[model samples]
Target chain A: MGKRFTLYTTIFLLIGIGLAPVLYMFIRSLFVDGGFSLRNYETLFQSDREWRLLFNSLSLAGATTLITVLLGVPLGTLFAKTDLPLKRFFTILFVIPLLVPSYILAIAWFYCLGRSGIVAMIFNADVGILTSNLLFGFAGTLFVMVSALLPVVIILTITYLRMVNPNLEEAAMLYGPWTTVLRKITIPLITPGIALAGLIVFILTLGEFGVPSFLRFDVYPVESFTQFSAFYNFNTATAAAIPLGLITLVVLIIERFFLRKKTFIFRTMGSEKKMLVVPLGKSKPFFMVAVSILVFILVIIPLCILIHKSVSISAYTEAFIRSIGSIMRSLVYASIGATCLVVFGFFLGYILARKAIRLFYAVDSIAIFLFALPGAVIGIGLSGLWNTPGTNFIYASMCIIIFGYIAQYTALGERIMAATFSHVPHSMEEAAQNVGAGWFRRLSGILIPLAKRGMVATWFIGFIFCLRDIGITMMVYPPAHDTLPVRIFTLMANSPEDVISAMCVIMIMITLLPLGGLGLVKRYIK
Target chain B: MVAKMIVKIDNVSKSYNKHSVIKAISLDIEKGERVVILGPSGCGKTTLLRIVAGFIHPNQGKVIIDGNVVADNGKCIIEPENRQVGMVFQDLALWPHMSNYKNLEFGLKAKKIPKMETRKRIDEIFEKVQMTQFKNVYPGELSGGQQQRIALARALVMQPKILLMDEPLSSLDADLSLTLRKEILRLQEELAITLIYVTHDREEAFSLASRIVVMESGKIQKTGTVSEITAYLSGL
Candidate 1:
């Protein structure tokens, strides 16, 4: 009875806070000012500009998904299933682009390929056609987005590959070479996982606001933001968001269908053997070079360019001094928000893990829907819901920003926690219960201790996401409540190149520091 | 003289999504008796054991342990902790995060045993299992036989009136299985507890059972002594 109460409370609270804004937006789009009407949506369909924005969003997402799958699947398989040299180091480097905010990556590319960039400076050449034409349009947006999102495919694919039963692979190897074995045995087994990863990347890219916004590529999120912020047309902005939200919802449903039957099976069983690693043989060096070059292009070059541009510590100091308030606010708000997410996520995860409630799939779908809603849409919805005439206390405080963070990133926390919880056998807790440990004792002594690593991981991921958020913060932040991402984004149009670069480098450092600390702790413990 | 009844499973039936797994099964167990539930895989032997241990609730009837109504017809359940039952799972289910000693100590501490009494009880069980030297080691660091011993020690330390084991030696090699089976028999005899064990292994069932309940398709086909079971098997 107590457990049921907790589960219902968590589900209701998550729906109330995390999902209500989007629900409000959807309902609001159906009405104009006071009465029920579809004028906003009608106007949305009537405008060619809106249609073009929608096309740009879909095309970018589709192209990014295709490119990511091409690069990520084979590389992920190689790293996970073959004897790739320095696999750990390369995997870490490949994932660096994912950790850096998308806008930061876009800015790095801009600095590297812009007219007065390093290449132009070194060659004393007019690369305006390449920089101005190529780097500021669809091509630059696709490139930046792919680099940032490819890790989703690679990481998830590697996980699925690891989960493929080794016995199946070994049996296939008896009949054919490793390549044939992978095709017949491994790939088919993990196809659902790969497809799920692809769909996630598709939805993420579709809803992405940062890279497109930074590169001046007109997409739905950017259009939605312009409608709300520039034109003060909340109704049109809400309507614009509906198409993107619906697309994301459709993709999320597809992902859910793929995940329903297979999610628990991918969990590592104690009896299952480790993944088989075939020797790379003579192609080892070629594989190593390929991975190294990819990492250099994706991770090392952008970072080096940022470092080169921010050579003066004085520039960093100036940026830091100017944005100290935003930086501090970012840390405080993100920490509070992440802590809340971890708490709520733990209960939500427990419900899913134990199937403690009926309609769990509905709860899961809601989480995914909220997560997949474009940040700009969520931003508009939050303001619409909270920015009331008399609710200034919440609207004018940091509460709104923190609420946005929780609504956006609790899904991430839930995902991490649910995965962790799946590995824990119900029998372990039952064993504890049979030995006369009550619920709290069993939980504290067994489940929490067992799941501590996962909890820590969820917290860190939530923290990083909150720290790097921009769109929702931009829309909801009170005066004097700017976060680091919003501050840097605002300054990019007018700040000196050195200061902008310095701030980007600082953001990278801030993100990397926690990751580095976690790595060190893991090594020491191991 | 007939032994006193310690457990009575009265017309217990269980189902998953309305596909019945345990079909109105009833059994009476006496104190100090070793009752082995022998069945093929998927015959609901483990489910029966769990229902008695209060890990599961039956759909049609009641489980009475020590004259107390523990569970009834899917409506009321005495939680596993309050049942004072000790179970050794097939996979051992030893908490991987703790040392072997801590695993044993957890239950004793949960029963609110004092620090000194808990330490003494844990030490005694560790000594009985000949695992005293490795008490501080985590289960992952232990050999299979040693880990099996730790699982036994963890259950014995609980000092419950009944001990339920579900194919606990199934994962071990033949030699290790023989050794652990002997250890289990010794523990059962020494503890003088009511034992309800589930196993599919014929030799294990024959060796450990004071009475063997043979089940097929969630129905008991026979309940008899070893010789009677042997006779029944030969007739089949």
Candidate 2:
């Protein structure tokens, strides 16, 4: 029961647990051409192909961050704290873009902009004009990524905005007008939240594979995939992962540094829960129209196109049947993975909350390392780890995919659980035990029950990450097995826009229906 | 008549490496005694109380509950749940996720109390606390005073031989704290439970305790009747 012994044991356990895959990768990266060498890094730089791909990936991520912030802030603000007409409707509509996979959006855009496309049809007389030209390459990639990631920025911004106390705004108004208040008080308060949104989007876009890969664009993830899957060069692929991983690490470091600065105060705590709504007045109609257009372009159009494409009788039946089995496999694996994640998340969260468990900084650093590692690196590292002699359990089994899911998604679940756990006072659990509640009883009846909302949030995050995941799944999936995302990605390259559209529509429908039901239940029950 | 030594602390010295927090302190509690640990902030009162409840272990001493040594130097024998001690926190640490009923039932069920017995106990406790109407309400839905009573009922339902509290009313408003202080003393008397209360409020301690143990800077300053302690503390 010595505190030092417990602290050391915990530190070793966490380090070993987190460092296993990375250590495996490091060992593999060392072995080059029958001997250990720095050949991987040397070759990684010498090869222009991989370097270009990394460059393209970073550029696209930066572009996406820029475009996402440009659009998401105004839109998130317009929805949450405004008296604009049909605000709730627009709020739901704007978030629908998140439901549709980015690859599906690419296919939809291809349908509308192809030579015999809808845009071409509408501008038949203006065909071949520069302004009416089809978007592809960097421009098309930027457009699609912005549309894909905008919802992320919007959700984060809106949540933080909702958390800001209106009293601060009221106080600011005493000094000046609404615009000045927004510039001085509101903007400063929301900056950290906005930065968090931007950091998340940047990391996500950096690792993005579906949009860039579909558009014939070379990015780091795609390049890493090509190096391993096409050329079978594991070292080269890992080398490709390093630069992007380093970039993500830098961003994470900066985020943590600024977050620790104590520049921001959480004014929302102990304040009113009801958010203040700014009246739109004459701008209400204009804002409504603009928001409606955004939803149409982002959510509705691609969805409608996919549905139209899927209506063919034979193709629809075949794809639907294939999708059914895929859905089952994904659900089983993801559910098991989510369960494991929640268990670990809750224990660690409780330890941090109650025991004030030391080694948090080291534990957190290791857990989040994978967050910055592109899925390609995870896939490669996993394959290398489990494919070695006598350790082939993960090589062909569903376990590899599950392991990848855990590594990629545990950080998200932990973050969610940690945020909620911090709000709970440890004294409560102590009090329960003071009442003769055993550890299990305290956890089951008191701690777990008190932290249910957080647990639910953890589950939701795990579920969403599992559902939308394509990068790791693609890298590790056994041949002849296809998840929904895999099926959609394959259809992207060969099938017409309609077929891609049709599959997207079904996927979104499956994802959204349960989510909508859950939202409703949460509203009424909790 | 022989007084039952319900709990005993023998040379309980708590330290972190070289820095001793509670230095060689020994105390004993008789059955149904109301003992207040009076201390300035950062004094060793909380640490000593925590050691008795098995939340913490003393670095150089032993804690005996019901004549059994639960914690000794380099030998912590009992986990907190096995201590059969009820604790009320300074913040009235009610389980926010559970209703008053579930919170009360949790401890009993954990000890494998029969379902029927558990229900009976919960009902009786609810009646005792005058919170039967709010049994189904969560901690968030209850007023602070209501929550304070529920927390008390939760601990009492376990029929703990001793109760431990760490400034249980410190977070409440002055008016509410004053009202709850009376409720606590009344409950202690009715339940006839040994109560170890920790607080920095001299007046609150005086009103609720038969004996006050004043602490300063992680050491026991004095232990006596409320009037004796007040006179002693004022002389300092």
Best by TM-score: 1
Model 1 docking category: medium
RMSD of each: 2.8, 3.8
Model 1 CA deviation exceeding 4 Å by range: A81-87, A119-126, A173-185, A258-293, A389-392, B1-3, B174-179
List the global CA lDDT of all models.
0.86, 0.78
For every candidate, what is the interface RMSD in angstroms? 0.7, 1.6
Please list all clashing residue pairs in model 2, or write none if there are none.
A306-A501, A306-A502, A309-A498, A434-B86, A434-B87, B44-B218, B90-B167
Could you say which candidate leads in DockQ?
Answer: 1
Q: After superposition, how far is residue B86 of candidate 1 from its true place, in Å?
A: 1.6
**Residue range A484-510, candidate 1, lDDT tens digits:** 888899999999889999988888888
Best by lDDT: 1
TM-scores for every candidate against the unseen true structure? 0.93, 0.89
lDDT of 1 by residue, B68-118 (tens): 999988955688888877889999998999999889988988899999889
